[model samples]
Target: MSGTIHSVSERFDFTGDELAPAYRAAVDAIEAGDLVVMPTDTVYGIAADAFKADAVQRLMDAKGRGRDMPPPVLISVVESLDALATDVPDAGRKLCEEFWPGPLTVICHAQSSLMWDLGETQGTVALRVPDHENTRELLSRTGPLAVSAANTSGKPAALDVYEAEEQLGESVAVYLDGDRVSGGQPSTIVDITGETPRVLRVGALSLDQLRAVAPDLTSDDDPAPDPTDAPEPKPTEDAEPTPTDAAEPKPADAAEPKPADAAEPKPADAEPKPAEDAEPTHEVKPTEEPAEASNKGENNKPDPDVRPAD
Candidate 1:
């Protein structure tokens, strides 16, 4: 019934000690089967008591999400992982030891004995220990809470309380305004229900960082080819140009008639003259140039001296 927003910044000055009143209001709201929007290390989240089925359903309905996409359970301590999840492998344990209380979500087999439903989870539960002190303290008081990003299913997650209010206004019963989240990136989620741990999503924690702890940790997007190491692909038949299309271009039929003109002395299909025939014509022109001087003593007959010169 207490659908009100409390500002931790204005009242508590972000002091962890002064946040008790706001935490109490959130806890009361959850116990009454209502949704509460609170700030986490990553982003603002709308949380409901995991054991309260109606509250969880309201949380899902407010976010426009379905049962197939179940929200994760947030714990105050790492030991709570056993209460919610089972079959925790060594690699999973190592990763939890290294990255717990931060942006890391591990999905494991749910404990069968627990009498609660979180939608169609398929016997698996996603768990996380958020790094924020205020959120963790609230978790310590309220136990495990089914939490999801405060936004419509397809919309961007809210970064602050005001954004959460704008997206999920009346649906949430209590709003804990802790200002904006420091870590903008979502948690890195890993599913350890199988023989090998496979990364379902990459977020704040990188593959390399996870590998440093669990060398065998694998992902569906593993072994990305290094851009520097990848060799440039050789052109194929489809992409490569042929010789005719390359540097040597095909000449047009009428581009230049010089080749045909050079071979034949006349235009069109006329045959070329023999070398001997061309030589006499050139020689007679030179003799005609001295015709005036020779006219006084010589007739139109061949000179006897020219016979040797012929």
Candidate 2:
């Protein structure tokens, strides 16, 4: 929450060109378990030590986020995938091999001892290998970083160093301004929880582009409701009910007439169904209709006059 701004990449300033020192400072803060807001190819992100629970909690609190949505953990490279996630499926590996160091967030099941408390993980976590050089270098020095876009809840994401500084204010220990972002959008998030993969959030990558890299990719297909509102319930139409009169039961006018002849009950024999309603039995023929047609004129019998000489 208290620190300095370091120009760690081209996007921040020309000084970030040799960014190891500033990145080192951010790494030091992370080692001491403090938050660092740094630039990714997409937008500025607030990061904390993945193993530091308290630091992670501060990140969640700072963003005014809930447990349902956990912060994603960014790794330096794809090799770190197995360290934080489980069951690296073919689809997951395929995508990682293809578009990883770009704008793609792969959501997979988390390993049990990941050590950070970002939110209610429900045994799952999101991970990404960022494309930015400063981030890669910082993550190389520091381990996996639990991070999200550096902005207050519900506000637009930070597009530059100043925007991040203005939005994050005192929440993050340091803001590493690299410069203008590589791309102007967030990462394309894909959830690989089920047997089939689902895109949780669509960002820079298109649905077609994602599937081309990983053929098995499918989308969850739910576009979220408008951010401005909790939808109001539709009103129901009111109608009036018609009243009915109560009636009293009347006695029989006279004694009921008796049957002229006594009827004998028949014995049950498959229970006589109404004659018209009985199910009919069908027989199966050896040669089917299609097979008979296929044989056609090939198996025709010889004519009597033609067979006489034989």
The candidate that wins on lDDT is 1
Candidate 2 deviant stretches above 4 angstroms: 1-16, 222-310
What is the Cα-based lDDT of residue 129 in candidate 2? 90
lDDT of 2 at 72: 93
Candidate 2 CA-lDDT value? 0.72
Candidate 2 lDDT over residue span 1-310, tens digit each: 4233333322224144677667767877788777787889898898888888777877777777776778999999998898888987888878877887989998898888766677788888899998887788788888898998988789988878888777767666666777768687899999876667789889988899988877777777755777557553332222111111111111233111222242644233324334354332232223344344434322343332333221
Clashing residue pairs found in predicted model 2 = 11-178, 11-179, 12-177, 12-178, 12-179
Clashing pairs in 1: none
The sequence of per-residue lDDT tens digits that candidate 1 reaches over residues 136-167 is 98899999999999998899999988888788
Model 1 bad stretches (over 4 Å) = 1-16, 223-310
